[model samples]
Target: MNKKYLQNFYNQYKVFDFLHTIRQCGIISFWIFLSVLFTTSSSLLVQEYPGKVRQYTHTIEFDYVNWTFDAFWQKFLQSSIRLEDYLPEKQPSGIVREYLRSVRQISQLESQINVIYADPKITDKVAAAKSYQLQLDQFNAYKKQLAPYAESTLQSQISTILSENGLTLIGQPIPPVLYHSTPLPMALIVSPRNKIQQDANISLLADMTAGDMAALEDEVMKNLNVSALVVPIGGVGIYPTMVMSTSDLSFLAETVAHEWTHNFLTLRPLGINYETNSDLRTINETTASIVGTEIGKQVLKRYYPDLLPPESEISTQDTTSDTSNPQATEPEPFNFRREMHTTRVQVDKLLAENKIDAAETYMEQRRQFFWDNGYMIRRLNQAYFAFYGAYADTPGGAAGTDPVGPMVRALRKQSSSLAAFLNQISMVTSFDQLTRMVDNPPAG
Candidate 1:
């Protein structure tokens, strides 16, 4: 009845509980493994086609198999430790906050170190970098230590919200709501030059330099006669999910939930048909976006209400002022989504007319325009749209004239609840099915 003896007893009980949980959920895990295997093999098959593209990218392509093995092992160790379980009732939130603060501090130190190296006046650049290296390393170690606990806390929080929304299976979420924050891989998106379509999406190494990305893109485009772009992504929907490391709690929550949604769908017909066609991909991405945003907002409101943005800040208004006093207020801020919508609409039209050169030239001009307006779009072409256009949760942006997104949104509006919307959509195998469902919702 000493502290050490009690702690040992608790640890043994947890092991028993873990074994029980695994015994009950082992089938689900097996299916998830099989689904991931199918998805990865499908991607490899797609990469193999147009073998020249792989020839150029194979050396630089991300080794997801090795990465997954490492990540899964790390996750297994963390699960065994269950560090968050030992925290006081209210301590997890503070731990998460401290972890985020450490992440921000590390980011600041990294920026400062880079600035030091770049300064022409700093003759001893190595020494200058070394000046801040100790602090950076300290913050990095703190972040690493806190990461597992933070991840567990957030996962539990998200799972609770999902359960409240009735997205649970047998009192638990499918896939058990797991995620890991790390440097994410870059995606090389390839599209046909004549049309805007994502024919291939290959993950590349996280540390690949801009020059290497550009060179690989150029080689693929020239060899395959395709429009190619190297783009950064917020998350990848592998098992235990891969999320980009960031200090933004809102984005982190949404991405974790978003990737979980992908795992949820992976066991269903819609996800099974995800790679079958472009429309299905759009539907899948859009569905995940909607679910992620809603669930993320709920998690924030329940645990980190102070961090939530004000209502007025949640969305941008097109109107500059009240109707009675138009001159009373400043002009509306630049809307990225609205402008991107216009660009997409125009590009779609030009591509339809077979004006490839004109479309390319126009996209360049618009890219520059976006840059001038603080958007900093590196490259805006068919591949860019093809890659980004899938996440059509909102009305505008890269979706342009694609009717799929609006239809998905409409279905969500028509459904009784988030769970209902997801259940109805998850069974959909094609856009036609979605269109039919939306057109003729069940009479309630």
Candidate 2:
């Protein structure tokens, strides 16, 4: 590994370590996962970009070093249990169940910590990754050293609530998994290529496509401190992890609904082979975002009604609740969703007419021409739809569907129930099959 990349990973480590010190705070797949899929996808990811499937099951360590943010998890559990007044009723076995849950949670966490440090952790594909470091395992050991004792106390308090509420719970381990890191918000780009030093901005992680990034340099490896709390990593099973500010807990379910969709699909990124493939990246993501949005709304409406009502338009205030102390300003209504639904129908028809170029041009100027002339631009053609599809909602990527999204959507559509959906897709064999199975799911 380039020392510089090692250094960069260490820098990320230090930042996560600091974030952990804040006692701070913190904080998924019950399917409703499938609904995120069962969406509008009807294309394959592999043919679009070859050699997509890479590995299986990422181990994400979700650490909450600071206890102050414990409120988020506490609230999340309460929403599900609906235990408004836990103290009013308590069962004698409650204490034992709560303790057992805690033990199971922490014990599993500890075992993972041990595995991370083991030499075998990266012996497979990760071993050859340009950014791989023999000493990176120690970062987990460092994280273990920094967990907030106060947070443990907070967990204890949370345990009491579970005891009284007729529940024995360990909140989904912050999904996929969370990690305690020093206060740095940096991320290390590890894969067959080295790009950590090349793309150091935190914004890039949230913005750029992993497949299109520049190559990593040897000098860049020396850029960081190994002792930092390197956290919630992005790997096979552990990714799309985000940092939330002191926003309201109210919208977390929605956020979880969104991210968990990524975890389930396990999209194959393009550009990992250094420009060998790029289209796959887009297909995976666009599919995921579109699916996630649809599924999240449906899940919220189906299971957690109080958090997300059926008939109401989701307010920005609710979505950003984690950060707002009292007031998260209201977001403007997106009447576009209503209008676009119908427009997409027509747009697809145009795309299928074989005048893709003409369709795209028509759609591009439709909105601009109409907005300037004072008319609604409803007939956006296929080309324009393709253009927006590449936009992929939350930034990053040059074009097409998001690999993660499409796979999840495809898997769900194939299975009758969520659990069955997960079981079949969890361990796929080939990238070709993975893509074909979902986008062109067997006709039912």
Each model's C-alpha lDDT?
0.85, 0.35
Collision count for each candidate, in order: 0, 70
lDDT of 1 by residue, 1-444 (tens): 024533764756555576767853664466447446645854654565456567777777777777676777677666655666677788888878988999999999999999998899999988879859999998999899889878989998999999999999887898778788999999889899889998888888899888988888888888888899999999988877899999999999999999999888888999878888899999999999999999999999999999998888765532222235656666666778888889999999999999999999999999999999999887899999999999999888898999999999999999999999999999999888999999999998
Per-residue alpha-carbon lDDT of candidate 2 for residues 340-418, written as tens digits (9 for 90 to 100): 4345444455655755555456456656654665545433333233333332433222122234344545566566654
The C-alpha stretches of model 2 lying farther than 4 A from their native spots are 1-175, 179-240, 243-252, 263-279, 286-304, 311-364, 369-411, 426-444
> Which one is best on TM-score?
1
For candidate 1, give the lDDT of residue 334: 76
TM-score of 2: 0.32
Model 1: what TM-score?
0.91
